[model samples]
Target: MDKLKLYTNQNFDQLRQRQDPLADQAVEDLIANPSFIDVINSWDIIPDQLSPDFSPRVRNFLQFYFDKQSLQETSVLQNGQDFFAKNGDIYLGLLGFYSLPYCYAFGDGAEVLVRSKRIVQDIGKRLAETGVFVMDIFRPNAFISDSRAYLTCAKVRLIHAFSRYFIQKYARDWDPKFGKAINQEDMLGTNLAFSMIVLRGMIKMGRNISESDFEVVLQYWKWIGELIGVDTSFWPENSKEAFELDRLIRKRHLKSTEAGKTLIGALGGYYKGNIPDALIRQQVDGLFYFFLGKEASNALGIKSTNALSGNLVDLVFRFSGWKNYGSKKSYEGFRRMMEIQQKEQFGEVIKLNLPQVIRS
Candidate 1:
């Protein structure tokens, strides 16, 4: 199959350097349009339907979590930084190869993603940008104040517009079950995967996150969701609500599909090619199985367990947890390590920018 040539040839940096006023205007118009709101409202079940009241536990947790002095401090920021530092690769793999492919398996989106051929590269670029966004959002004075945040929002709008285009261009090919490529439910599900699913993955890997830090991380994504035009009405206020919503969304949308399996195979193949060491590759395979569990891994055609390597990975995580617990210096070291890794992976932390056109 010929690869789709849907995106402009210009790179994102070039696109930003030569900003087109018309493109900018189109994005602003899309964000302001009421059609998005109508689509969100059309959902059969909203967040409120799942959890109407913010439970006392959640309320109290937030009250203390967001106390003025706490916000003034950098402990929460450090914790957020430390999380990625310790589990950056694992988090990226889970989202890109595991959670995302699982989501893509739904309807024609899988067809779209798998057929693109550039999907793996696109995922890599997005993951790199996401790490930048995470660091910026959690930095003391940079949350919502930084240019990276603004650019991230712009990129999101462009992606969302591209989804709208796909839905219109291929209306006949669309599946009612999935609604559209970037439908409200799917958008919310993506957000949940980044926060709730990520948290779950961390725990599975034996990382310990404090309650306060966890809430703050969710809050950060909630703000990002709002900025990117995700309906505020469906945003979960706390982890408990997020978990419930995650479960409900998965139950409604997740099913094995051939397109999904193909996409997963493409992603796995990409990783296998890049990772030369057989032992490390085997451990990564185990990690995928561990992260997604038996059912999801099987659906994606990921191989069964490498029990020894998997257990070894778990043991390493446990040891790291034991050594790093409550140690600020340890977290600081991890943060620096993560920064170095990002620089190596992406080559000098390129600024986030809006794409001139959709590439995938």
Candidate 2:
């Protein structure tokens, strides 16, 4: 607890006030590019274009964001990536049930998501897009010089920059007390939601991820943090530190708020419609309680349910080993689910547009 206090007392206020200057610069450069209008008009990633056409100047300017020139991969990172591929289904499940809801528990961070109207209005599509981003990055040999993952990270970073820019400029209701939109602390917390929280969920489900594996997963996301402009200078080094970090953040920000409730309500509605089976839906709620625990579930207004539902959810996901499921099959199934989500939201698979295009 003493060490935990030290971490919690660190000037997170400074982190909250900061935004990603590199990604913000990239967005500024992009908007100023000679082909800005032409590119925005034509570049819709309907088929998921990994590489988009940019003028030489714009491309050169954006290269630092995508290239990850400083990242050095090792056997541990490769193994971590391999672990994610082998358990793609479980990874996605943890994301939806545990990670996203856990994020919503943070009052201020959830407020930013609430202001992002697209997230509340069409959450299914957002979920699909989020899944696609994760799959792209975690795929074997991802983040290479020409890999789609690099571009995907770059795109997301730009999206964050867009949200920060727009909200600060247009959101009259945004309080200064809420800190900067998409700030550094929030970004790091989100990264933990994907990496450490996912590992914690795996442990809850009876999987025994070794300490080395856990540490490598943290390292893998550190590389991601670098690319996405999250300052990871204080990122946790092991499971113990990770837990402390998560607990510290939760202590500071986990509370009931309209923003958190709205996001979870939308999530529940989307899953309820798609799940179809009453029992599975109950299990979904159980899984929420199971992973998020009492404080977070209550923060999101998740209803209390019998313990059986959570245990059953555990039984459904728990398996003997990491590689029990084939990555290809899991990827295809997940992609199909996302396509259905997109088709439902729009008339067809929706094209990815710049935030400017999206807003316009």
Candidate 3:
């Protein structure tokens, strides 16, 4: 694993400097043809339906990006999809309790999130949109040619570019040392948060996933990483690599910052009252502490919860998770809950913040 260190510093530095050129180019095209922005904002059309009035580069990029010809329906991928289908409720819980909170521990990337008021101010909607994206990719046959999943990925990638555009143009306080807003390294880190970190959380909760299953989950997100413009060449291929990548990233960037605290606090505020038990609800910080571990929780300034509350929260999660592991009813319940949350957060339909144009 020491060999991993040899390439990490140089490669991660390069990745930190890189942004999604394709998506950024599309943003530039939009700026050059402002009318095209109106067309994309319409929220009901696909790339194929765009008229010649749109910039050729933008149209071509949209078609190429949304096309799913590059995705392979291998046995490993299908296994990954099935795994998600069986355990999606647990997966969603880990995303909320572990992966996203893990993300806020990174100081530099948290700065970008802090600058994006929509994410901090509207944490519930952001989480719902993220859940939608994850479900879209996890769905069976989602990677089939020209599927809605690709459109979702394309929309998110472009949204990143738009955030970059707006942040670079505005946000006068943005420091260069953080790299470009939503740089490749940060995106890759976020990808790992959703994939490797979620799996790790499952392990922490006494869930047993085979090594093969774990690798496939990572591979599944590698494919997703490619679709979302993350550099998959740097993506981990196995447990050892994934662990080392997380270690390296944590060593380099897992420090406290106001931005990190702000993001995590905002998230915590949004999840208030989500717990059923009144006593447990009072110790919600215990849930954060349980999944994120002491270091990350401390970094995010999560208040200490009593030992009794911490163990109780862990038991509750483990018990519920065990009961619901592969139940379709549980999956549907989670989906229904998410739909209600989305409706409450973003009108009757979950219209994502940027580039609403996707084929209905």
Candidate 4:
């Protein structure tokens, strides 16, 4: 930790010159965009179905960003199917991966943003094979690997690392875009990412049921509980998407059927890193994608997961609000987020630090 601080001091410009010159340019270039500035200087995002909607400050922030007509015109329901990525809720939600650290790094302290941008640039290089936005690598269509074994291992490792950070850090927000929040597309996007991580890894591994694979798979579930503030069991019993995910996970992991009871950890215990078994089993919406992907894959006779992942964009793009719907409201803590928005909206002396509120 101390080493990181020393390396990324206020004089980061000077620091980067000494260590990496190319990365310095990339970060410098990305930070210079007009939208980037607006995102950084903004506050809250409005709720879709939740009550007490956007604060005046957040409304003003949107005014600078997406005017009412602009945002509305791109609605998934109204726009037919082309509303997911190019111009709608999914795009807005994904903006966190695209715009954060660059934007909300200014959330708590200015240094968080600086260090975050540095982290993104650095990680971007180390995992250039993976992707800055993780879905590309972990999905079915990353690289055509030299060996099938390497692809399997890479997918597993990538998914494990992603879920670990996602549950532990990504959901943690100094602001909406900065941290991982359940508010992300009303759980649609979150479920999709989680389920896909497991399925992609499993498929890459040739649907193997090895112990290590089980461990990582379980870790996926434990992490899911860490980030999702709900009864994880709602998946297998309640939602069809959840049921399909469980079915695939079970079929792939059939060997350990008896000991699977231990795999179910209390949400709090799972979050604390206690392992009864690897808890990566909450398949979220894995079934939908899996069925859709398999049907497509079989039709194409494609063996590589990366190929399927690649086609996901082309396939899902036809639906505008695939990642949308709405969400329930949370009881904001004592500080009152509404008050902060009001103060900032009217140009009152204030600074918005979402970390002070947004618990998980």
Tens-digit lDDT string for candidate 3 (91-134): 88789888988999999999988888878877766777888888
| Tens-digit per-residue lDDT, 71-163, candidate 2 | 657565577777775666778879988899999999999999999888999787788778778877776666543355666676787788878
Clashing pairs in 3: none
Candidate 4: list runs displaced more than 4 Å. 1-130, 133-193, 196-201, 204-212, 221-243, 246-294, 297-360
| Candidate 4 lDDT by residue in tens digits, 1-360 | 122222222422222122112222322322333243233324233222322343443333323222322322222222222211122233222222122211121121222323333233333222222222232212221122211212232223323333333343543443433233222121222343343333343343244334433333333333332223222332322223443443432232223111111211121122233211122122212322343344322222223333334235323422323322223212221123323433544344233211111223
Question: Which regions of candidate 1 fall more than 4 Å away from where they truly are?
Answer: 1-25, 28-98, 105-112, 115-117, 120-123, 144-147, 170-172, 209-213, 276-279, 308-311, 315-351, 357-360
Question: Alpha-carbon error at 129 in model 4, in Å?
Answer: 14
What local distance difference test score does each model get?
0.52, 0.74, 0.77, 0.28
- lDDT accuracy of residue 321 in candidate 1: 39
Top model number, TM-score: 3
Best by lDDT: 3
Model 1: per-residue lDDT, tens digit, 1-360? 111221122321122222223223444443445343333323322222222243443233223312322233344445555555565545544565456655654533465455444465565555556655555454434432233334345455455555455454655755544444555555666677777777776666566756765677676676666555565455666666666666665555466777778777666665665543454454555666777777777766777546534456656544443443423334345445546655776676445543343324
How many pairs of residues collide in each model?
A: 0, 0, 0, 19
- After superposition, the stretches of candidate 3 with alpha carbons farther than 4 Å from their true spots are 1-6, 41-50, 66-68, 273-280, 308-315, 318-333, 344-347, 353-360
